[model samples]
Target: MLAGFAADLVVALHFAFILFVVAGGLLALRWPRLAWVHLPLVAWGAGIELIGWVCPLTPLENVLRRAAGQAGYAGGFIDHYLTPLIYPPGLTREHQLALGLFVTIVNVVIYGMIALRRCRLRQRSRGEVARS
Candidate 1:
């Protein structure tokens, strides 16, 4: 039972990590310092998808489940849980690549907008200083 509970906690943490990977750039826009933390996560998340690397969490969770006398699952979290809800079919390599591409595109757009806004603010502040 204790192992099962630990496995559940791992699952929750894994899901939260996925959410952070997907949308954490938005948070970084509000807190620029967070980029140092978020960028590495983005890279790891995208690499996992693009390179087809299994997350270590998968095996850890599986071991926990097995220790609890439950049958360990065979694949990553997305393959077991998310695929059913989102894809209704098996997750293929192309789909994984697409997910990586999607993450890259989203962060690019978010950071691009942040850069544009900062540039405009700098220009506006300079104009005000000149007028003063």
Candidate 2:
């Protein structure tokens, strides 16, 4: 029972991490310091997809599930949870590449917006200083 609960907790944490990897830049837009944390996570998440590496959490979750007498799932967390919703059957190398690219592109756009906003703010401050 405890193992099953731990497995559920891991799954929830895994899902939350994935969500943060994809959309955490929006959080950084609100709390600029969060970018320091989100940026590394973005890299790790995209790298895992790009390189076809299984996340460590997947194994941890599987082990916990097995300890709980549950059958463990095949493939990574994305394959077990997300691929069904986002992609068709049989996730291929190409699909993985696409997922990685999608993640990168999304974060690029978000960070680009952040940079533009900062630039504008800097310019505004400069203008104010010049006027003063």
Candidate 3:
């Protein structure tokens, strides 16, 4: 029972982490300091897709599920949980590449906006100082 609970907890955390990786830039837009934490997570998330690496959390969840007498799932967390919702069945290498590219492009656009906002703020501050 404890093992099952823990496995479920891991699944929740895994899902939350994926969300942060995909949309955490929005958080950084509000809290710029968060970008320090989010950028690394974004890199890790995209790298996993691009490199075809399994997240360690997947195996941890699987082990916990097995300990709870449940059958473990194959493939990574995204395959087990997200792919069905987002992509069609049978995720391929090309699909993985597209996912990685999607993640990168999303973050790049977000960070670009952040940079533009900062630049505008700096210019506004400079204009104020010049006028003063």
Candidate 4:
């Protein structure tokens, strides 16, 4: 029972960390502080994903599940969970790179828009100061 609970916690954290990486990028649009960590993680994640690499954690999780006598999934979490939602068939190397690119592109657009809006706000503030 204790081991089962521990395994559950590990799985939960694994899933939550995935969310933290993705949603965290979106949240960074509001809080610049996360950039210190999120920026590098985003780049690393995209690169790994684009290269069709498996993270070490996945194997570790599989090993644990096997010890627990559970059926371990073959691919990464994205393959088992996300692929069904996004694609009709299996996720290949191309699919991983595509997902990485999509994430980077979307985050870039979000950051760009946020920066542009901030610049406009600053410009307006300067103009008001000059007028005063």
Candidate 5:
């Protein structure tokens, strides 16, 4: 009941953070302030994989699930779901490093574009203002 609901909410939040990491970059183009939140998520994604650290939310969700008499998950979702395809054989040191680099690169590229776009917009606006 309550425990199940809590677990579900935790899972949803976890998924949402993943979305924020990717989408937040594009969103930052329009609202640069969002970079504050998005950048941290990028770092977190990379750091977690590099350090082989599980997100705190996973344990919280697992505890709720267990309290609800549901099964608990031992590893992070990526390790369980993506590792099969991404890692294939096993999560070797190189594979783990690659995963971290992948996340960091993807995030940087996204945010980099947003920053470029923002700079263009600002410059354009200034040019117009100068003319007026």
Candidate 6:
């Protein structure tokens, strides 16, 4: 019972991590310090997708499930659940590449916006200094 609960917890945490990797850049816009945490996560997430690496969490979850006397699943939760939802035809290497690119593009856009905003603020401050 405890093992099953642990496995479930791992699955939930894994899902949350995925969400953070996907959307964390927006959080960085509000709290710049969060970028430190989010950037590495983004890189790891993209690397996993691009390189087709199995996340360690997948095996850990499966082990827990097996210890609990439950049949372990073959793939990660994304492979079992999200892939089906997003790609009815099923997840292919092309889809994985697209997913990785999507993450990279999204983060790049968000960070670019943040940089542009900072530059504008700096320019406005300089203009005020000049006026004074």
lDDT of 3 at 22: 92
Question: Model 6: per-residue lDDT, tens digit, 1-132?
Answer: 898778777777787887898899999999988999999999999998899987788788889899988884445664477534433477788988898999999999999988998899999999999999
Residues 26-116 of candidate 1: C-alpha lDDT, one tens digit per residue? 9988997888888899999999989999888878888988998878443556437853443335889998999999998898898898889
TM-scores of all predicted structures = 0.84, 0.87, 0.87, 0.73, 0.71, 0.85
Q: Candidate 2 versus the native: TM-score? A: 0.87
Which portions of model 6 show Cα errors greater than 4 Å? Answer: 72-89
TM-score of 5: 0.71
Alpha-carbon runs more than 4 Å astray in model 3: 72-89
Candidate 2 displacement at residue 80 in angstroms: 10
The number of clashing residue pairs in model 3 is 0
Residue 112, candidate 1: alpha-carbon lDDT: 90
Evaluated against the true structure, the overall lDDT of model 6 is: 0.83
Global CA lDDT computed for model 1: 0.81
Clashing pairs in 6: none
Error of 5 at 21 (Å): 1.5
RMSD (CA, Å), each prediction: 3.8, 3.8, 3.8, 4.4, 4.7, 3.7
lDDT per residue, candidate 5, 1-132, as tens digits? 798777767776777776676467778777888889889888887787789887798788779888988774335564356324422566676776787888788778887787788799899999999999
Worst 10 residues of 6 by lDDT: 78-87
Go through the candidates in order and give each one's C-alpha lDDT.
0.81, 0.84, 0.84, 0.67, 0.74, 0.83
List clashing residue pairs in candidate 4.
none
- Clash pairs of candidate 3? none
For model 5, the superposed segments whose C-alpha errors exceed 4 Å read 72-96, 121-132
- Which 10 residues in a row give candidate 1 its minimum summed lDDT? 79-88
Candidate 6 lDDT for residue 46 = 95
Deviating ranges (above 4 Å) for candidate 2: 72-89
